[model samples]
Target: MQRIDRFTRRSLLKSLGVGAGLLPMLEVEYAQAQVPAPRCAFIFCWPNGMLSTSAATGWPAPSATAAGITFKAFQASLEPLRDDLLLLDGIDYRFLRDSRAPENTGHACNPGMLTGALFKAPGTGTSSIVAGGASIDQYIGSSLVNLGYRGLPSLNLGVFVKSTGRLSWRAAGDAVIPATDPYRVFDEIFKGVPASGGTGTPTPDPTVTRNRSMKKSILDTVRKDLTRFNLRVGTEDRKRIEAHLSSIRALELELDRQAMPPVVVGSKPVLPPGVNTAISENFESTTNMMIDIAVAAMAADVTRVVVLQLGDQGNANVILSTLGYKPAGQVGNTGNFNGHHAIAHRNAADKDKVDTWFQS
Candidate 1:
C-alpha cells in the first residue's frame, strides 16, 4: 500500500552518484527538509451510485457513528478489495451548489466529481454546462509538463466514451479529453522516440525529434548555467541546483521509461487461441478486463496515477448485467438474479433479501 513512499529523491540521487558518501551527513543535519519527490498517480472512479448501506461497512464494531451509512452484507463483492480501498462516507458535495444552474439537477455529481466546478446548465439533453474545468488527472499532467515532464505524464482511460471528459479543466477550466482505446493509447505513448539504439522502423515525427533535440539543448544550456552559478552563487544556491540536477536526471529516466511501449500484459503468457479481447464481448468480461488493465498499468508503472469511471452517469446500470443480476442467460445462472440497480432499491426496504443475497 505504501509502495509510493519507498523511494525518496535524496536516496535516489545518492544512488545516482550526486555526492560521495554525503547522504548520511546531510541526513543528520536536515532530517526534515521537504524534498520534491515523485508524486504517484491518484486514480478515482465511481461508476454507479453507491449503495451506501450495501457498499460500505458501518462504523467500528456495533455502535460507532450510530446513524451514518454502514456496510451491509451486500458489499461482499468489495470485501477482497477493502484493504486497498478507503470507503469514505457522510461526505457530501454541497459546494457544487454555488453555480447558477438549477439545484437538484440530473446526475449533477458526474460533472463536479473531478472539476469541483458547479454545473451551470440544466441536466436535460446536452444542456448541462458539462464540466467547468479540467479534472484532477489533467491538472496533474499539465503541472508535470510545466515542471518539465515532456512525455505523457497522465493517462485517462475509459470504454465507449470520448476522451474529452477524461481531462477536467486545466487550460482555462476547459475539459481535458481522455484516451479511450487501449491500442490507440498505447500507440500515443510510443509514437515518438524510436527504440533504444535507433534500431526500429517507428521513426519519430520530424517535429517530435526536433522538440526532443531542443529539450536536450536546453538541458545542456542549464548544465552550463549551473557550472557558471557554482562559481558565483551562494553555497545554498549551489546545493539547490545540485538537487535540481538530480531531479532532472531522474525525470529524464522516467521520460525514457514512459517512452517505452507497453507490451500487452499477457503477451508472454500462454493463452488459448481466440481468447484475445474476451472482455469486449459483454459486460462481465469488460469489467474484468477494465480491472485487469488497471492492475496491469500499475504493475507496469505506466503512469502511477489513473482514474477509471465504471461508466458515465446512470451507466452503472450497464454493468448490472455483468455482475450476474440482469440479462438472464448472459452470464449463466449467476447473472440472472436481479438487476444491479435494483439491489440498492431492495436494500432500502427488504433486509431479508439483502441478507439472503449476501449469504447465498
Candidate 2:
C-alpha cells in the first residue's frame, strides 16, 4: 500500500470529486484507497431514544434480504442515503439497565448509551453523575492517537450546552464538553491551514507568528510565577495552581506547533462570514452551522473522530414548532407541546415524529 500522508489523501479524495456532503457514499471507497486513507468515526447522538416498538413506528422493519430494509414513512428523511445507512437493532447496555434505579432509568441511560457502562453512583450529598468509563468515540480516538495520527485526538461538537447530558467521556468522571460555537471550532481546527492560491511552502504570516510567540512568552512567564508561588500555598491551592500551570504549558506547546508550516493539500475552505458562532435562539440554524464545521474539519483531516451530541435527554428547550408539527398538547387541551422533552413523554406518536425529525 502507498503510504500517503493526511494532505495527500485529502487531495486525492477532492480530485475524485469527493465533498463533505458525499462522505457517507465514499466511506467504503476511502477504506479501499491505495493510499493510507484517513479513517473517521462519527457518533451522532440524540436523546429520548428512537421509536423502535415495531415497523409501524418507523423503525426499519426486519428483512430477510439486504434490499428489504427500507427507510419509509416517518423515516423518509433518510431516503437519500438509505443505501449507506446501517441499522442495528436488539442492542442494549445491560450494565446500565442493571445498575440504575428504575426511577432514574430514562436520564441515566443517556451517559451509558454510548459508553456501554453503568453510571457511577454519586457520593452522599452529591447530585453529580458520570459515566463509568470512556465512551466508544473517545476509546477509538485514543487508539488512533496511539497509532500516530496527528492533530486533535477528537472533536466534540454540539448545539447543546455543557450542562446537557453528555455522550462522550474521556474517562470515568471526565465528560468531554463540546464546543457549541462553530466559528471557534473552525478556528481551533483550521486556523493554521494554508490559504488558497498559496505556494507549496506557504510562508507563515508574520502577525500570526508574532502573536503565537507573545502568547508562548506570556505563558512561560506565568508558569515560572506559578512554580515560585506554589511553595507558599497550601496543598489544595498548590494543586490548583499546578493544574493551571499545566494548562498554560499545553497552550504554549500548541502555539509552538501552530507556528510551524501547515501541510497543505489543496485550496483551504473559505470561512463562512457573518456566522452566528454563539449559541443561537434558532436551534436548526445552530445545528446546521455546527454540522458544517464538523464536516469541514473531517475534510481537512483535522480530526478522525467526531462525536456530535444532538440534544440532551429531557431537555425542554428545543422548539420544533418551525418544522410544521402541531404543537404538543396536554391530554385534552390543545396547545403547542411545552417542549421537546414533554412531547417525547406524551405518547409513541409524538416520539416517532420527533425521532424522525432528528433523523432527517
Candidate 3:
C-alpha cells in the first residue's frame, strides 16, 4: 500500500484555506494560537504479516543503529525516511493467536494487532473473525476527549478495504468499518465544521450564502500570485510551495476533474457529488485523496486520531504494477492474481515486489 500520508499536504491547506486556511478570507476562523500540538497517533496497516527482509529475499536485513534505522537493497526506497522509521524486529500478535485465534493465524490475528485481546473467530471459518476490544486509536481518542480535545473522537479510513479487511474496533463484535470513499470520508469528518474553523453551529446569513455561489477554489485566485512568489523564493521554498499547490489540486479533484472550491467560507463545505471512486486505475488518486482529507481533518482539528489501513492483514487488495516489466503469467492488477494477498500466497519471489512497491 502506498503511504497516502507521504502523498498529500495541499489538502491541509485547502481544507483549512477558508475554514482556517485564512482568517482574512472567512468571516470566522480558528484562532491562530500556538498551543502545544495535540497528542495524536496514525496507524497505517497492510496485509501479509510484518514484512521482514530475509536472506532468501536477497534484501539486507533492517536494523537500527545509533544514527537511525537502516533499510538496504530491496527496501532502499525508504532510505530518505530512515531516521523516522521504527523497525521492531521480534514483535508478534501471539497472545490471542495462542488462545482463541490459533486456527487461521493470519486472519485471526488481525484484531489482536490493535486491540491486544483474544479476537472473536465465530464459527469454524476465519472470515467471521472480529476484534474483541477497542483498538489503541480508539483508546487514545477517548483519552484525548477526556482531556477536552474537540472534534471527532477518532477516524477510521481505508483504501480498497474489502469484507475481510476489518481492523479498528469500537468494541467486541462491533467493528468500525473504515470509510473508503474520500468524498464520503471528507463529509463525515468536516460536514458540521463551518469554513471559519469555529466550533459553534453556524446560523445562515444572506450575505454569506451569496458569496458561496460566487466563490471558486482559492487556488484559482492564487495561482499567479503563487507563481510570482515562487520566482522570488529560494529553491527549497519554491519546491515546498509547488508541493502545496499540487496537493491542493489533488484535494480539489472532481469527477470531471474540475477544481473544487476550498471549504466554503461561513458555511459547511459542499463537495460535488459523482466522484468515481470505484475504478481500479483511479485507486491511486482515491488513496492519496483519502490521505489529503485525513490530514486536513487533523490539521483543522476535525479529528486527532486516525487509522489509515490500506488493506487488511489477510485481504491485501492493492495491485503491484510492474509498470513496463511484465513477466510471463503475471498479467498484473486483477488479472492473474487479484492483489498482494494472492501474490503472497501464490508466489514467494513476487512477494518482495509488493514490499518494494509500497516502500517506493
Best by TM-score: 2
Give the clashing residue pairs of candidate 2, or none: 327-336, 327-337, 328-337
Q: Which order, best to worst by TM-score?
A: 2, 3, 1
Better of 2 and 3 by TM-score: 2
Scored by lDDT, model 2 comes in at 0.59
Q: Name the better of 1 and 3 by TM-score.
A: 3
Highest-scoring model, lDDT:
2
Model 3 segments beyond 4 Å from truth?
Answer: 1-35, 54-64, 72-85, 191-275, 316-338, 346-349
Runs in model 2 lying further than 4 Å from the true structure: 1-36, 53-57, 73-85, 100-103, 121-127, 192-281, 325-338, 348-350
Tens-digit lDDT track for model 2 on 1-360?
011223322233235331221233223122122455566766677666666664546556666555676656765666665556545444444554564433355665666655555455555211255666676666666576567666566788887654746777766656777788776666655565665533244456666677778888888898899999999999988866866775575456546555665444444445557755343235666777677666656655566677777766655556665465443444332223545666766766667666766777
Error of 3 at 237 (Å): 62
**lDDT of residue 291 for candidate 2:** 74
lDDT of 3 by residue, 90-124 (tens): 44445554556656665556665666565545465
Kindly indicate the candidate among 1 and 3 with the higher lDDT: 3
